[model samples]
Structures are given as structure tokens and as C-alpha cells.
Target: MPANEKLKEKISHLPHKPGIYKFFDDNGIIYVGKAVDIRKRVSSYFNRSAQHNKKTLKLVSQIKDIEFTIVDTEADAFLLENNLIKQYQPKYNILLKDGKTYPYICIVNERFPRVISTRNKKNDGSRYFGPYPSGTTMHVVLDLIRTLYPLRTCTYNLTPENIAAGKFKVCLEYHIGNCKGPCEALVDEAEYNANIAQIKNILSGNLSVAKAYFKEHMAAAAADYQYELAHKFKQKLDMLEDFQAKSTVVSNTLTNIDVFTITSNEQCAFINYLKVMNGSIILTQSLELEKKLDEDDTDILASVIVQLRQEFESTSREVITNIELRLPLDNVTITYPQIGDKKKLLSLSLKNALYLRKEREGRQEKNKEMSEQRELRVLETLKKDLRLTELPRQIECFDNSNFQGDNPVASMVCFKNGKPSKKDYRHYNIKTVVGPNDFESMYEIVTRRYRRLLDENQPLPQLIIIDGGKGQLGMAVKALRDLNIYGKIAVVGIAKRLEEIFYPGDSLPLYIDKKSESLKLIQRLRNEAHRFAITFHRSKRDAGTLKTELTDIKGIGLSTADALLQKFRSVKKLKDLTLDELAAEIGKAKASILYAHLHPAEGENA
Candidate 1:
């Protein structure tokens, strides 16, 4: 295996320190690797005595150049290699096939921190918890937090100066006891942060701390003879216990450890991770890697261990895996249990990995069949992108149109199985809202549309799209909340400016790829809604103008004006008609009055 002279010279000068190395071909970098001894590692690839696998032989054959970055330690090298593999996505590195950004519970860094679910983890100093593998589990944790301790959900800047200056008011959440009135300074900063601290503990898998806090408060309230306050604390404690019990408890002995397992075929590998806290599984995640080389399970698992631990920020000292792998994690103990509670935990993790592999295989089969129907494939894409529990077979989008508050109207366009269901489309004349209030108009139309569906026992749409920003979307959420059907169906708002998708209660908007089919489908629905609303609004405005012009005449009334407009489509066309032409369509008296109103100069001349 003789390398090029230039490559040989470059490899000869490689550092002996721990670092990452890259192999570049004519096109670009094809592989990235980490090594404790960079010189030794790169030299092994070109040694004629060492037999190499097919993938490695092919990779080494294309090596036109080599680059290396020296780092402080082996751990740093591993981290850099993983990051480069993700960034450049070198051809020969293990490919993470999921291509998904797992959701994390973000505690926004602000005066009044918002606890919300976000897929993005930023470095702005706010705490993030759980790149949760399951959205439902993350939501359940979030719901429990909100239930036990009321936090502000509104994206209000509740600074000290703003609160003192009376710049904000308590919202409906405050009235409903879902938020303490922190905006108006009714809740002190210290007390609010105390709740945040407990929230952090809970999210960090220290449920015992939260339970103890509630118990201590409950005891104090009871000692003060405040039965109601004591009862509230007791309820919170009970909820915490219930939540804890629901989590899988693999063992009472194995505390604060991580369990990992891996399974693979020739093409790809699957790895499952379990974060165990106090002998209970707090988090479960599975990852898939496409094997470009003949990498063993030990190497794949070791890479995933570093990646997942860094992602989830696990500081557990002990890690139990199904296979043995030596890693350079500081102060961490890696163990492979043969039999015991640790073995059961390992078995549980392996089960999840196998299940994920099975699910992916089945999905691939289903996707092949789905390719036959483009609509189904698009719907599948949408379902995955939006994290919807079910396919959006039926989607309805709403848009409102008005010109300076007159003749306001709204249109609801329905798409069934990725195609317009024209018969299911609807138009609404603004009934409740007085002026050009898009938010209220959206609320009214959404309410009216769904209420009618509910009344008639018709099936509701799987998803609702509001063709506006967060304001309009929030109002729709309020309407659904009032109707007690807020979470029954999935809904999002799409802003036209950037095509930002706003989920209910999420302050941050999701920006889908500009070229994605899901976004294209959403945009089509939005455009259709806008076009429908604009057309209806134009008709209404024309009708209103025609009526006003004709009724201004002495003898004309509502029915007569309608009759004249019905006979002739627009006021412009009616004005162009002769008086005899108008009289032929309507009665002589009303027609003459309308003709006079239309042609005032002609009336005076006659």
C-alpha cells in the first residue's frame, strides 16, 4: 500500500500528540479520525504488512492529502472529531441517519424565565434539559411542572423597571391560576426564582428535592394552621410521587448510572441510551448510524456514548453497556454486567434499540409503498416534520381580509389528503368582530367553523393553519381553549414574511426549509385561503357600495337594491346601462330611482 509522495511527506510530519486527523481526496475530505498518537494512527493506514478492510482500502486509495488538528487530550480529540464529522459530514465517518434535532426543555434566560419546549439549544446562558427522545414524555414533564408551579407563558419583558412603571398587566393565565402575577410585581422575584430552582431540580432528574420542598412547605402551612395552603402543597407532593412511580424503576441499587446498548447489521447500526437516576429510567433515546466502514459495535457505541452524554449533559460516573469499550471519559467507569440489576437495565436498553431498528425497517417498507402515491408521501413528510401524532389527512387553513375595517370577511380552505377539498371550503362574513381586527376575526371564524362541525357531529380536521403570525395564532388557541378542544387537534400559524411556523404556546417560531414539500403544501393552503378571502371581500365590498348608492335614492330599499345588483353585477355596469335597460330588469319605480342615483346628471337633464 504505497501512498503518494506528497501524502507520505505530510503523514511523516504528523504530530505525536492526541488530536484529530482528516483524509482529503481530490473532491473533498472523505474521512475524519481521532487518535491518541496521530503519527502512529496515520502511519498504520499505509503500512503494507497490516491487512485493511475493503472500505478502508478504498478510503486510503483516494487519500490525496492529510490534515491534523492537535488538541490537549484524547477526550478533546474525540469531541473535535465528532463535531467535524457532523459539520463536514465526511464520506467515510459513521453517519447519524436520523437527521433530527431532538427537542429540549429550555429555561429561557431572562428576567422572568419561560419554561418551554424547543428543538434549538443556544449558548445564551439559559439552562436546557433533556434532548428527549419522546415529545410526549417531555410534554408530560412540562405539564407537571406547570401544574405544580405556575410560571408565566407569555413572552413579556417583565423587567424590574417595567414592572415598577406599570407597563404590563396580568393576563388570563394569572386569573386562571396558571401563572402567578409576576408581570405586575404581585409575585416577588425571589419567590418566582425559588420555583424556578425546583423546576430545574425536577428537570435534572432530582424529583426527591422537589418532593421534599413541597413536604417542607406543607408541614409549615399545617403548623401555621393554614389547611388550604397545606392541602395544596400535599397535592403537589402527590403529583410528584405519581409522576415518579410512572417512570420505569429497573433497580433500587443501581443509582445515577447510564445504560447503553447497540445492535447493527452490515449496513447500519442502532444504539439506545438510558439515563438512570435513583434507580429509575429518566430518559430513553435511540440513535441510528449508517456504517461506511466495517466498524464494530464497540466503536459505534463508544462514539454514541460521547455524543449522547454531551448532548444530554450526563455526568453519571458509571456507564453500563452491552459491549466493552475503553473510553477516555474523566472519572467515568464503564462496565459490562453479565447478570444482575445492571444486566436487566442493559437488556431494557437493548430492547429499545431493537424496537427502533424494527420500527425503522417497517417504516422503510411503508415508505416504498407510499412512494407510489405522492400525496401520501408528502403527508408522511408533513407528519414527521410537524411531529404530529397522526397524518394530516385533512388540513384547514384560515385567512381574513378587510380594507380599513369595512366588509370584513374570512375564508377557510380545506385540503384533504394533500389536495383541495373544494366542497368543504367555507366563507365567513365577519359577525363578531367590528373592525379590521385580524386576531379577533381569526378567533371568530375558527370558533364558528369548529363549533358547527361539532354541532353537526362532522369530523374535524387533523390540523388547522392560521395564515398569520403569533397574534392570530394565539387568538385561535384562545377560541379553542374556550371551547375545551384546544389540544384535540394540532394547529400552527404560518407568518408570510419568513414562513415561520408558530406552535401554540411556543414563543420561538420554527423555520422549515424553504424547499421542503411540507412547507410548499402549507404555503399552497395559505395562498388559497388568502385568494379566497380576498375574492369574497371584494364581492362584499362591491355589494355594499352598490347598496349604498341605490338606497341613497328616495324610492329604493334593500330588496330593490339587491334586485338591481343581481340583475347587473356591479355598480359600474349598472351606471353604464340606460334607464329603460334598468326598468326592464326591475319594477319601473325602483329601477327609475336606481337609474337616477346612478346617473344624477341625466336625472337633472330629464
Candidate 2:
């Protein structure tokens, strides 16, 4: 295929699917990448303004053909991409090379199988327990199982025919009582299988079955006056409890999992992997990835899981991530532990990822020439995160405040280059709409604010933020549309619930990363607008109350009210005055009426 036509065809056919894409040439796959949208990411490479590095440009030049594998999830794509990259050793991809594999506990399939740890888990007839994060703790579990149960440690097959022929002899393991000497027919198959069953339960982190069995036997023995056997059962149960107490962190019930966390900046992502075995962290390691594209947390995490598992040789079948991750592992279970020991492990993993991110950022800051880079990075991130056409250098936020259908007011706060511009701050009194109509109040203020700006030829903000949800945002958008600035000005609403960002005419909220500076800036704007509106509303309410306050008293006209206000200056001071004291200021008849009105409960004083 001709290069231009092939490129066009590939670009046109790219689907908005989550998967891994490979760039191939005469030399084979030169680059492999995973994307939530294959079309977007791939087409971005072809855009002349994508600002490709020299290495990337050279790689793109060598691309003769493109191939892709669509997967069920971003995580599946991540794993597949990692595998393909490792298999082909793609030159354009950054490899996190490590030589260790995670270990798993295997119960060998036999008439009387042995429990042991191995690097690989094969699907023979045997039961496999782990791809444990920590080999050391798994080792302890194996030892604990051996300590609790008397299973054979011999190499002899101990077949039934051989035992019947009396061909096998007891070994040192039998002499030491580590084995029940099944080779010599001292132990039968049913007794050996029972011990194996209990071991399987323990290895799977379910001690209840074994504990229940032991307690049942102990109670029955005690009922029969078999004190020695009952005491032995009690000792075994106590031993199991002690072992579980030492290994378990949050709860004794949680076990056999790997916890993962991810933290990142614009340039890189730091992933922390926690090897959780038997509800305890056995080992932890943080790996850093330099981002070639702007990938989200799931993308970064999914890719890292495959690489981390492959690099560390992890055999764990259960994965606990700080956030939800859907991977296509039929044998593996994925979870987002919100509480208990698993939650704590997830948090610890997050802490590690955060620490690594901070350390790397600190190192980078030291090497850089200016701190303004941080500010630029924030602006760029804010732009991308909010999906703005340009940087939000100038932003205006609006809020409405009212109390019990009285004194409705609105406030607009302006932020320029991420700092509050108090000079441009505005407050509006609701004139067009009566009662506590928040949506209409928002419309009035938004229309008045922007219309005035237009009339006066004042510079309008690049962004308008409404301190509300979809309803208020639509009202504001209507105001803009009436002014013919609907599409010209970028307007959005920030709902207090979930800090959701809602666009005009859209019910689905856009959730930015909670830790994102863009979201923080939006939150700050919303809060500032709220504070400004509340302050305005309070002052307006107080003024309205005071204006009619004196007139409300009986026989007090405007003149009398003005006379009393002038004499006392404050209504509170006038209310405190006795009839005699008030009589000195205004005559006794007026004083009696004023005092009577002020002290409604004290009719005797009137």
C-alpha cells in the first residue's frame, strides 16, 4: 500500500475503542501503545502541530503499517500492550526492566500432595494458592501449615500396591514424627486427605473451617471426659489464632491480594505496588513512568499492573486498586476496598505513590531554572482538564443568595491569572424576579453583568462559572444566548454535590480529578462567589429591616420615626431606654407609645 493512502485509511478506520495499537515496519513492531480512543491518540501523531520529539518523528517516518488489538477494557489493553512490547522489544517504548517473578503457593496434586511455593502456577490437577506479593510471608504460611499438620516430607510415592507388598521402609521424617509413615501403612488415605483439606482452607485464608472442626471435636471430647484430647484441640486452635493475629493487619479475614496506587504530574506517573498476603503487606515497591501522552489514572495504572506483575513475578490472583480497574483476567479478582484492612493497604499504597511523586518532583524542581514552570504547568493542566479552548486566564464566577424568600441578591467574582480581582467584583439586587427564585436571580445577574461589560466595552472573562448545577447553568446560558454571547463565552456550573462540573444543556456531569488544580480553582471561585453573595444579602436584609423598623411602631409617622432615630441613632439603644428616659427625648405620650411598641411583652411598662 502507498504510504499516504495507507495512513489515510488507517486514520479513517480508527475506532473509539480501548486497546493497544502497534506501529509496524520492515523491521517488525517498532512501537506499541495503549489508548482509551485509538482514533484520537493515533491521529494525534499525524497532526503536524503535535510537536513530536526527534525520536518519535524518526519512528513515525519508519511506520509502513499499523495493527491494533481491541480489548474489553483499558486494563486489558494495558496488559496486552506490555506483553507485546516485551515480546518484540519495541524500540520507541520505555521499558521498566526487572528480572524477578512473584511466587505462588502450590498444593501438588497427589493422593497425599505436598504444599510448596513455586514461581509458576500450572493448571494441572493441583490447587494453587498464591502469586503472593511477598515471598517471605508466603514462606511463613507454608511453615505454619507444616507446623499445624503432620504431612509427609518424603520423596517416596507410597503407592497402595507397594505398601501391600511391604517394599517401603520408614525414613528419618517418620522417626522425627514429621510424617505419619504412610509408606509403612501406618496412616491410611482418608486420614491424610482430611489433613490436606484443612491445609487447603488455611492457605486460602479461611481459618473458620479448620477452627470450627477443631472446636467441634474439642467440645465432643470434653463431653465424653476426654480431657487430654480436648486440651490438644484447644492448643491447636490457640496456635492458629496466634499465627493469624501476627499476620493479619486490619482483619484476620482478608488475605492473598496485591494493592496498587498511582500518582502523577504532567510529565510522569508513579505507581506503588503493595504485596499483600494474609491481610498484611509483605513488600512494597514504587515504579516511575515518564508519560509520552496525557494519560489518565486508569491508563497509567492498568499499564503498570501488567509491567509490575511481569517484572516482579507476582502470582497474586487478587488485585486491590485505590480506584476501580476492570481487567480481563478470568482467574483474577479486582476490587476497590473502601474500608477495613484492605482499605488501609490501598491507602498505604497511595501514600507510597504520593511520596515517590513528591521526591521526583522535588528533584526535578532543583534541576530546573525557574519556578514559573509550575504555574505554566498548572495553567496547561487546567486548560486540558476542563477541556477549554484556551487557558482560563480571566474567569468570572456567579452565585445567588437569599433568605426565606426575602432579600435575594447575587454576586460575581472575577479571577485574573488565578488571583482574585476585587476591583471587578460585582453584586446585584434581584429586580426582575420576586421571591426566592435562584434560577431567575442567576439569569438576572449574569445578563446584567455581561450586558454592562458589553455596553461599556469592558473586557469580558474567558470563562464564566456558575456556582450551581445544571438548572442555574441553563438559566445563565439563556441569558448569554439572549445577549448573543452563548457560544462565544465558555460557561459551566459547579454543583456542590460531588464537585461536579455541568455544561449547558447537559445533564451528565464532568468529573475532573479531585486533586486537579483546575477543579481546585473552580471550587475556590464557587466558594468566593458564595461568600460575596451572602455578604451582600446580609447587608441588604439588615438595611431593609432597619428602614421599616421604626415605622412599624404605632403612631410613629416618618417624622416621628426620623425624630426617634436622630435622638437615639440606634433602634437597639432606643429599645433599651425606659419610659422616663424616652420621655426626655420625645414627650411622655409619644414615649409611652414608643416604649409600649418596643416592649410588646411588657404591657405594664406601657
Best by TM-score: 1
- Residue-wise C-alpha lDDT for candidate 1, range 161-186, written one tens digit per residue: 88899999999999999999998988
Q: Which stretches of candidate 1 lie over 4 Å from their true place?
A: 1-3, 12-18, 48-50, 70-73, 97-99, 219-230, 358-606
Angstrom error at residue 472, model 2: 80
For model 1, what is the alpha-carbon lDDT of residue 547? 83
- Candidate 2, which ten residues in sequence have the lowest lDDT sum? 367-376
Instruction: List, residue by residue over 152-218, the lDDT tens digit for candidate 2.
Output: 7665677788889999898888888688888888988898899899988887666778999889999
lDDT of candidate 2 at residue 512, scale 0 to 100: 95
Report every candidate's CA lDDT.
Answer: 0.88, 0.81
